[model samples]
Target: MTETHAWKAEDFAQVNAPHVKTALTALQLTGDALEQGGAFAEIGCGTGEVARFVAERGFEVWASDASQSMVEATGKLCDGLPVTAEVCPAEQLEFPEGRFGVIHSSWVLHWVTEIDEPLRRMARGLRPGGYIVLQWTGAHPRSEGPGMFGILRDIAGSPKWKDLLAEAQPGSYEYPAEEVAKVLEEAGLELVHYEPDLPHPFSAKKTMADLPEMRERYKLAGFATQAAALGDRGDEFVDEVLTAMIRAGKTDPHHARIVARRPAA
Candidate 1:
């Protein structure tokens, strides 16, 4: 798999604001948290919009991401904005125990195959009663039927590719709030709130909140590499997938948000 993405620091301009809105809505952040001394951290803070939003709300913000491009972009976006940007992956954070009043993540935890370890690490970093707000893709099919990956597999005549994706963990664990709460409780986090029905479009015409972050995700999910391998038929393959998504998004929507908190000791 190609670890580095062909993306620019400025390309994230499309995604920052919408994600900031989503994070703020999910966090239910109040003006009270805007007071001085409130500390907040965002994992996978691309381009630093969310960090700036929290910082503006009066919380000291720490933004981090694994991608150097993302980290650099975030630093530039948050420059002179009372925010700290760093290159840190969710699994390993360099911070003292119980340092943050709020821990927020946007469309990040899912990329982590080992979800539990990161949650444990986050728990260790959160102050008691601090909230962890997350907006992520849930278990849902991209298309009405077999999905784009399935179509690509058929076109390329490869059973292995189909099997790999079919076996891939569905977009998410697809558990309800109580189920998520159980996981959090076991990890020493108290269940505060979880809602898995936030509907967002996979693709949209404008770059406004109408579009979910799936535009970049689909390409990054090895689709671009596979398309390149498909040779001359790549253009047709992408068109077919996009046509299907346009049709599906008209009738079905797929997106969600989940929030939990570390208990006060």
Candidate 2:
């Protein structure tokens, strides 16, 4: 499960506003399963921006995330709004069967390791005609290997941080559209839309040009081991990783998107 304490809610909200906005736009194109008396649900709701936005659309929204800080932030963002925020991991989500019209997750899916269980759970939560819109990618949507996590690991294994981050297991996994489709199929969700390397708003990916800021992001994004081990020193290590990413042009990553639905029958 993605660690919660390492996340900075405000920081995440600032960097990922575009992603939530894009997800909201995709949800707008989805079918009207909510008309069947099902509410809208968002998995991995970082700061609850999507929940707030959707609630404003006049739908009761249920949102969850593994991070308690994130969940709390969601509550703050959607205060007095028709939204319910909870602290739950995607894999352990226990929504009532057929309770949601749309189950959405944006930049959150890539961090998940137990992919099948989460997909299965989300599928179970969907109403018969309900849909799920997912956005994810591999490393940089354009690159073949070694994303931010790999860079962090490489820096951790270097001479300077090798001993300091010895127990650091920092890694982020983003999957491709085809891979996501296969998982959705395995979970019994019929594919509706597939956009590979979706470039539109996804181009809003955080660039690697700002080394210090990027390092701050890297450390705060579930790098508990490194943070606990080196404390303030982790910043230097993250800077080196960011420098390497800049050198390799791993600046603008995109995400592949897929929209799928449960069978109406």
> Please, what is the TM-score per model?
0.69, 0.82
**Clash statistics: count for each candidate:** 1, 0
Give the per-residue lDDT digits (tens) of candidate 1, residues 45-144. Answer: 8777778777877777888886677788877777777788877666667556899888888766644545666777777777877777776643343233
Candidate 1: stretches off by over 4 Å: 1-7, 29-31, 34-36, 139-180, 201-237, 243-253
Candidate 2 per-residue lDDT over residues 25-136, each given as its tens digit? 7776576643443488888888887888778777799998878888899999899998999888766777788888888887777667767677877888888888988876
In model 2, the clashing pairs are: none
- Global lDDT of each model? 0.59, 0.72
Q: Top lDDT: which candidate number?
A: 2
- Candidate 2 global TM-score: 0.82
